[model samples]
Target chain A: MRITSETVADGIREQLFTIGDIPGVLWTPAEGSGPRPLVLIGHGGGSHKKGWEVVSRAFPYVTSCGFAVAAIDAPGTGDRPEHPEIRRLVALTQEREAAGEPFWSGPEWPALNETVAAQLIPDWQTTLDALRKLDSVGDSRPVGYYGLSQGGEMGIRLVAAEPRITAAVLGLVGSDWLTETAARVTIPVEFVLQWDDEGSPRDSVMKLFDALGSAEKTLHANPGSHFRVPSFEIDSSIRFFARHLGGPGTASGS
Target chain B: MRITSETVADGIREQLFTIGDIPGVLWTPAEGSGPRPLVLIGHGGGSHKKGWEVVSRAFPYVTSCGFAVAAIDAPGTGDRPEHPEIRRLVALTQEREAAGEPFWSGPEWPALNETVAAQLIPDWQTTLDALRKLDSVGDSRPVGYYGLSQGGEMGIRLVAAEPRITAAVLGLVGSDWLTETAARVTIPVEFVLQWDDEGSPRDSVMKLFDALGSAEKTLHANPGSHFRVPSFEIDSSIRFFARHLGGPGTASGS
Candidate 1:
């Protein structure tokens, strides 16, 4: 469990923000409650905020338990400002990154690691910082991070680079620089993965799960292909949060 | 499992048919495949033949597990010869039943209940019959029915009108038909409901699930609003078939 009974009652915000000039739906709980934790949701490669519908539905699991949820739209996809930050960096890294080893040598997009970390990550951080300022929400401080697929990778990056996000729930995060970075994070982490995720295989993801500096890490593995392998979806993971992220009545330690 | 390791082995043929002469896909297992089970896959409202990606992926499940898996296009949908099936049926039934009643109502292009039974259910049967003739799939029988949303309701009708299908698994079946047909079904059934289903309220669907004629039945509930409510996508359901429909070595009994 990332948060506990103490963190469940105070976090929830209804407003939203634009980080890196990107639109984000911000969810924070009622006021004067306590120091409530916050969560930022990221999406998949071909996904959008609407794609987070299921993930957001699980918000009540956290909110009812006492934490705020913010589902964000990654820059390139959503209505966020067309900042050329990551795009520019990706363009710069393209020829160079593409020329690197097999692990890093994929078709270069407009942004690569260093570029995305420098450009987009800041915008992502800005979204988190904004979450901390919700007037109706407690202290606006967050206790953990959670995301899926590509979002999972983003969450890992958030924790790796951002000291404020102390714990996380990352699922379907393939082993990549994002995950390798996850190793440096000292936060308690729980990873939910599926066998159907043929993308990078569990071994790859496990490598990241193993690298996490925290001794409190746990892994939940379910069978089935990436599509239908798990009988439980994000809903099940929310229950896991009840153990760590706090439950009803308690103030989520942000 | 209805069919287990002790079950005998029988081969079935993959059958192809049409709705009023439209192209369709069907598969029937070998003779010893007794009172064999049946499952008709209905495409989503706007989806078509290629949309049956779920069906094609699950054919092995049907043929192997002693099931008759037949896929047909609803009038104007899929490879089914596009015609006035949706319209003609609407005109015919509105006079006898409430426009809101079964065989008389709901999104049935021209009418609702009429399409549920006459067009949807019948076409499904035709696909089953086509299964019977296949040389490898000897047992020509019907014992189960399955559908999603609109297809879920159609599944209810097949049990009411055709004595062939004895069981069903309906997901997110839209309600509102109880007023027209007593909504009572005598078949053994299982329901997977989505609480906040955007397409239909959980209460509306639960009403339909509740009205079943007190037989052996089970209901599995999941979190998430309407859209995400129906567990898994087309592919997920296909895998569900693998778990329920038996495997590729399906042996028939009929």
Candidate 2:
């Protein structure tokens, strides 16, 4: 875990770091005395680790409640070098969209998306391993995850495979390609769905929530497009995480 | 290829035989002499070799047009044993559909479909190798393929890998998840598309047709549902095969 740069602002400590070749960010409460509960944020497709800047603003409130937050760019997003095949797909998608054509449902979309998502699961898992070793972070801290769109899609697999993630907030995603993975997730989950999402149909999104195997899961559906998630729902997600990670919210070793 | 059973029905000689473990059937004009152009047919998902019966009725007409037609069951269909995983998926699809739900867009659909399609390409190729060695069949014959839905999907892979297939009629199927394979197909192709297909959205189907690398390709679009393709289109397909494989269409080795 190598810290490339560090800054302290308004009593919040932020650092840009790398785990081997992976670029990431870690934000911790500056005035905290000991280890604190940690939350890992995931950004959507084409976004980087800092794609959560506005969401990171909300993290200050989380840190105020005694927790740390961290995130890394998915492969081909952020500071990570772009995958060649995904780069070609991005170019093709743009070319089609510019020509007033459909892109997401095109012939190559499913295979390309699968290729990218397959790379994301292990990228996140390795980042989690490194994040666990930082100062004020501990092995026993109850870790949680928050991501939307691509993040939410891959987060299903992340949460299921990583026993450390006790709870997760996955939003703006459906379970179409990941049904078997969704069925394997037994952690507490807060899944947000957009009722009128054009990308993922309403019924499919509902079916996704239905497919989750978690005994304790909640659906926070808002009547909006895929991009405009209601702010109130965001508040509700914070509260959901707080309830799950609030008490004794300290990392074990720090 | 040993002919296990030979029967004369309605002036068509139907012979059932096995090429090693692969079971198949051949249909030719009962009264014809010498070799004829050969056409290979592929069955769809959850359907066996006999699934071509309706098409076979049409095949007798094709045999009357100076061609021999044959079909073999795809993996997990007909005489081939049902793959345990696909059997589970079929049960799950049925269970969901029986509950007034959408099974095809669910999470397991892509993975299940891919598993079946992957097994189909080699299966069809091996059957082709055997069919080529039969008495009325010739190694140098100009071969064509006809398949819809799952068969259409896997046929893309077969036509690309098996240079023996000089032409094909891939109908009522959209080209997602197989665009790479579709791009590799450079032979003459006659693709069918439905204007209002509930299963395959029009734009995606159009995009799939656009992705084909064939220098000489034609799209036959008609306004119909996925299942209700007009009979006239079927006649057009037979004519297309007849032109590509009839009369002077002599196998290179015959």
Candidate 3:
């Protein structure tokens, strides 16, 4: 892992780093030195590691909980070089959408996600391995994943495959294809759903929530469209992770 | 309102009171005086004002948020004298259950709820009027309501009728009769649902949630039976009420 740039602001240290070809960003309390619980955030489709959604959650995880938070560009997002297949699939879906047709009804939607997962999932594993080696985010601490929408789509698959993730706050995507993968996730989960989400229907979102194998899963649904998740949910996630991963001043962490 | 008894424990002041023929209890921070946000807790079926469910939530609203909390006996429960009609209906339902039949399938279920709501709703309004007259619980402060199951049934009615209540946390009920009443409630609500609930099916609970008129309503669903709502939800309620009613130390309250 190579950190190409580092900056500090508002009591948080932000580091832009690269592991092979994957680009990522990490945030931690500026004053802390040793290991702390780390939360990996996955951005939504068309968004990158430093997107508003990722930064909004990362800031609180670092400043309030004194935890390490990281986000990485997916196969063709952020600073990563473009992939031909991903670009082609996204363009097809966008064109379908532009023509006043439902883009998600087409095969390209799932195909695009599959292509991204093929490379992004392995990239995430490599990033996690490198992150754990850092003194500020050692392997001893608990790990959590937070993602919504496309992030939630990939999160179900990643959390199911990655044993290192002990807990997750995921939702906003409910493709039928992820049902079996959701069942393999037995760790504690806090699933979110937008009651009026246009892209992801409430029933499908709930079906995914129901498929989760976690004994300690909670679903929080609010009335809103796909992009209008209430701000209070962010506070709820902080408490969820704090309960499962242990906050900085709490007994569970340093 | 007449105070029958008063006690202080664990930094909470508990007062047993009676307004006319209605028996009730109130809890508040033992250290402070003057008006604060008041949360009226409605107890579950076959339970009374001081039942475990009521006391558990009451204590936190008092000690944690420094809010005044209160609960009242339903028409046929607690210290209130029993009515023959309520007793007869309950006996019939209990007999049906003992016969390995679903008691809720019978007309006796709705009849029992209707019988209780007729008297209990008026009693709650009277108690609220009397409580607001107290020096420590003046009329100016915001009022919130918390109840589930039977309490939820009564709460949906009361909140719909009572303009004084500004927020509520209600759920665990989905009586078909309450849909119209639920729509009249426009305040912010944090509705709770217990998945796999034997008495309240998940779909019914969610349907009621959908009927709510409140634009700011949220649903928290956890995987458990009727009686197994996770303890974390209690903490979540504290935050919910604290946000809407304004905790004692916060700018929204004293």
Candidate 3: give the clashing pairs: none
lDDT tens digits by residue: candidate 1, B118-182: 66666666666655555443344444566666666666666677665555666576567542442
Q: Per-residue lDDT tens digits of candidate 3, residues A65-121?
A: 889999999988899998889999999999999999877889999999899999889
lDDT of candidate 2 over A1-254, digit per residue (tens): 89999998776678889888888888776765455677888887777788753355346544546677888877787788858988887788778777887566575666666777787778788888887776566666689888878778878878888888999988677657778889898887877777568776666765676678886665654445787675545655666677787743533221
Cα lDDT tens digits, model 3, B1-254, are 88999998998889999988999999988887777889999999999999999988999888788899999999889899978999999999999889998777789999999999999899889999998998778788899999999999999999999999999999999888889999999999999999899888899999999999999999999998999989999999999999998856333232
Candidate models: Cα lDDT each? 0.55, 0.72, 0.92
True contacts kept of 1: 0.00
Residue pairs in collision within model 2: A35-A251, A36-A251, A176-B107, B140-B251, B140-B252, B141-B251
Q: Which ten residues in a row have the lowest lDDT in candidate 1 chain A?
A: A1-10
lDDT of predicted model 1: 0.55
Q: If you assessed candidate 1 against the hidden native complex, which CAPRI class would it receive?
A: incorrect
Supply candidate 2's per-residue lDDT for A119.
76
lDDT of candidate 1 over A18-99, digit per residue (tens): 5445566655454535555565666664466546443454456445555656666665556545547656644554556456
Q: What lDDT score goes with residue A247 in model 1? A: 44
DockQ for every prediction shown: 0.02, 0.01, 0.96
